[model samples]
Target: MDSVREQLQIFVRRFGLLNATCCEACCGEDVSLVQSHILFEIRRMGEPSMQQVAEELGIDVTTFSRQVKAMEGDGLVTRRPSERDRRVSLLGLTDEGRRVLVRIDRYMAEKIGQIFSVMTPFEREVTTRSLALFNEALAKVGEAASDGKNIACCN
Candidate 1:
């Protein structure tokens, strides 16, 4: 258990998720990991509601609102009121945001490519599957706990 925890910590840090800023060539701005994620999701979902992106990212609305405000200041995203629901704010990337997302995508792809280049095809497949399984399991656990179910481990 300790080994698993330690290895996961190392893996998280190795991904630079804790980095204060990304490479200039990538976003050419002080984009944090979370901010990059917001941009990526907006591009992927194509003008989703702010709440939708926040929920998908598992970020609280208040926290997500702040991040959106910052991104807006950076001119990477724009928010508009939904036509169907005046109260709901929809999020979309600006032209600059799209460019930034492209750079970020390329940068991440190159990094993953390098990592996979070292491993055999089978190894890569297993690694990918294991990570997906781990994520799914954790999500289930999180949902159960939040729903106030038997948190036996917590007890």
Candidate 2:
């Protein structure tokens, strides 16, 4: 049997999670995978602060800022000072961004549907539940590591 890390690595590769640009064909834009994630988060959070989105995505502020800047240049995102706090920059999606996000969503939905089509109904349910459980466990581990808890090293 493959080790857990090996299985995860294979999954990631198969899903194209590490690709540089993933949505050009589907969305008709040169959006990187990271930018797509940022767009999704911004749309989901509804004008979240730059820092808030960064923390949610587990990305450092500096790198996130650069990505956001590039996105803003592309007219896919807008950053404006919060009315209540001038220091805080809130993010929003442009119309173009929204369209692109919709395309990406459709593409992903189709891709996931195709993957799940091969499974039995019971298998699909189990896989969905297992993924949720795995994500919850991953979040807990992330929180513990962020809180300075020592995690065992493979080495």
TM-score on alpha carbons, each prediction: 0.87, 0.90
For residues 61-109, write the lDDT of model 2, one tens digit per residue. 9999999999999999999999999999999999988988999998999
lDDT of 1 by residue, 126-154 (tens): 99999999878877886777653332353
For candidate 2, the clash count comes to 0
Clashes of 1: 0
In terms of lDDT, the best-performing candidate is 2
Question: Which segments of model 1 are wrong by more than 4 Å?
Answer: 23-27, 147-155
Q: Rate the local accuracy (lDDT) of all candidates.
A: 0.85, 0.88
Q: Which ten residues in a row have the lowest lDDT in candidate 2?
A: 146-155
User: What is candidate 1's TM-score against the reference?
Assistant: 0.87
| Residue clash pairs of candidate 1 | none
